[model samples]
Target: MRVLHLAPYPPARDGIGAYARVLAAALADRGHETAVVAARPHPSSPPEVLGALGDPGLPEKIARFRPDLVHVQFAVPAFGLRVPAVLRLLRELDAPVVATLHEITRDTALLRAPGRLLYRRLASRCAALIVHTRDARAAAGSAELIPHFCAPPPPSTTTSDALRARFSLGSAPVVLAFGFIHVDKGLDVLADALRHVDDAMLVVAGAVRARDPLFKPMELRDRRHEREVRAALTRHGLAHRVVFTGHVPEAEVAAWFATAAVAVLPYRKAAQSGVAHLALASRTPLVATAVGGLPDLFSASGSATEPREAGEPSRGLLAPPGDAAELAKAIRTVLDGGGHPLQGLAPGPEEVAARTEALYERVLAGAV
Candidate 1:
């Protein structure tokens, strides 16, 4: 099977792009010929990345690949925030399309159409639609819940000790806020929560998502957001307690996760979180907001009232979204080993890839 994907490829610093790259690789490893078309694909992107999504010759490139199916990694921000343009592209494409709607906003501007929902029209054009969680599927109105990929930790060059020394983390317990910084990701909430905790260094593991040609997720998202986050910490007298590592290289991601006392996903809103998946892969205990798809990330939130079953290895704690006090309390619980880890409640990479491939087959045969 020749599967052509449309997404943001490597070196773009977008999570969806990384997800697409992982899925594409998994399929290719299974003997399927897979290629990606990113929006202005990074110059360093692998050969499997066919070309830029908006190139005049993209359609010709698709012809050359002769794909059996088109899998579009759909996130409005990844497509220059143009919903109609995505629909237009899907309509123009020749092969059967299975759009994996990455970010399903039930309350976004375009989602609430005058007469009909945007997803209604979106569903009409594609052979099938894939969403990462039940919440996303419900938000889409009609879509299947295909669990996102959560692989075991990648090989690491840096160890926990090296990370501690590099960041000057001396005996201070660390709370990691990983992934790209954004307003909705609730860095301010985490800062406020840190005020209630004691002796914990908040390691912010990434910078703001920059504006790329195809993935202009945050035109206004700049270093200012980082400054604002730092300022909030300063005001809370947590200036010394926060370490902002601009961008963690792939090889060092495991180290950050391993060094953390707990990985916190303080998102105010989200369709799903790849960071949560990554944290789980690294066996980091997590304290995530009980927002879209987050509750789904854990088998059970916390075992405060009841003890975990034998061999469970249960390890996540959840708090109400935007609640600083509750967030702090959950962090305390996880830090104390009240719960043990972030083993994903989702399927593994091979399983996710196989299921995706099956879906593609179903779509191509018009049996979906």
Candidate 2:
């Protein structure tokens, strides 16, 4: 099978880009011919670049590739949140299209009304639609549910001791919050939560980037939020307890997960999280707020109760969103070995890729 993926390519500094690279590699490993039409030019052979999303030559490029399946990794901001333009592009594509909708925002009446209209139009055009969470599936009306997949962590070369020594982190327990620094991620809440957790170092990974690439032109370089976070830390006497490792290499991400006592996802709102998947795959105990698809991802038994059967532990702990005291308590519990170590919860990348392949076949066969 020949699969053509449309999204940002690897080293593009976007989550969809990283995901496309992983999914393409996994599909290739499974004996499929995979190629990408990236948002920007990359060094990948056979010239993968297709210019930007709104480029006029995209249809010609797709016709040239002539793939059996065209898989689109969809996020609103990636297409500049231009609903009409995106809908037009989807209509123009004459392939067996399968779109994975990354986010369906419903936070406000203003965004929700048009967002729904746009999604319905896109869904009508595509052969099939995919979403990561049950909530998203329900909201999308006719979309299929697929869990967000993650590659397994690489083997740790350096120990926690070495990591601590390298970063000059002493004996304090480490709490990590990774990925791009955005207001929706609730970094402010995280800073407040750290105030209640005693003797723990908070590591805020990744650098700030434009929240909306199209509208927010200078938002990438804006550090006002960072300064506010720093002020909060100083006011709470946590300035010395937090470390900001801005924009570390991708290879070193696993090491950060390995060194942490607990990985925290303090998102105020989300559809699903690839970071949460990574922490679970790494077998690191997680502490996330009960939001979006997080509860579904963490709970083995799919209930608020503990994991069914004796000796089988739960994946991680969940607290109420934006509740600093509760988050503090959960963090302490995980660091104290009271939280369950995630085990055998998520499917491997190859298995996920196989499922995706099956979806493609079904779409092509008119079974969807």
Tens digits of per-residue lDDT, candidate 1, 1-368, equal: 99988887777777788888888889998999998888664679888877875667877887899988888887766666445656777788888889898887623533356314666777788889999988878777777788887775568898999989988989889999998887788888899999989878899999877664544435465456678878888787789888999888888988888888899999888878888888766667889998888887665533332222234454778889899999999999888887544443467778899998888888878788
What candidate 1 gets wrong by more than 4 Å, as runs, is 81-86, 106-121, 212-225, 300-314, 340-345
lDDT of 2 by residue, 1-368 (tens): 88888776666677777777778889999999877766555455244555445667867776777788878888766555444555666677667789888877532222577667777777788899888888888778788777778565556665677768877789888898988886667788889989888789999878786555554743543466677888999998888889998885677778888778888998888878888877866667789888888887654654444332345454478889888888889888888888654544566678779889889989989999
- Looking at model 1, residue 292 earns an lDDT score of 85
Candidate 1 global lDDT: 0.79
Q: On a 0 to 100 scale, what is the lDDT of residue 179 in model 1?
A: 88
Candidate number of the best lDDT: 1
Worst-scoring 10-residue span by lDDT in model 2: 302-311
233: Cα error in model 2, Å: 0.7
Off by over 4 Å in 2: 42-60, 81-86, 106-110, 154-162, 211-213, 217-223, 300-315, 341-343
Deviation of model 1 at 305, angstroms:
14
Show pairs that collide, candidate 2. Answer: none
Model 2 Cα displacement at 157 (Å)? 7.8
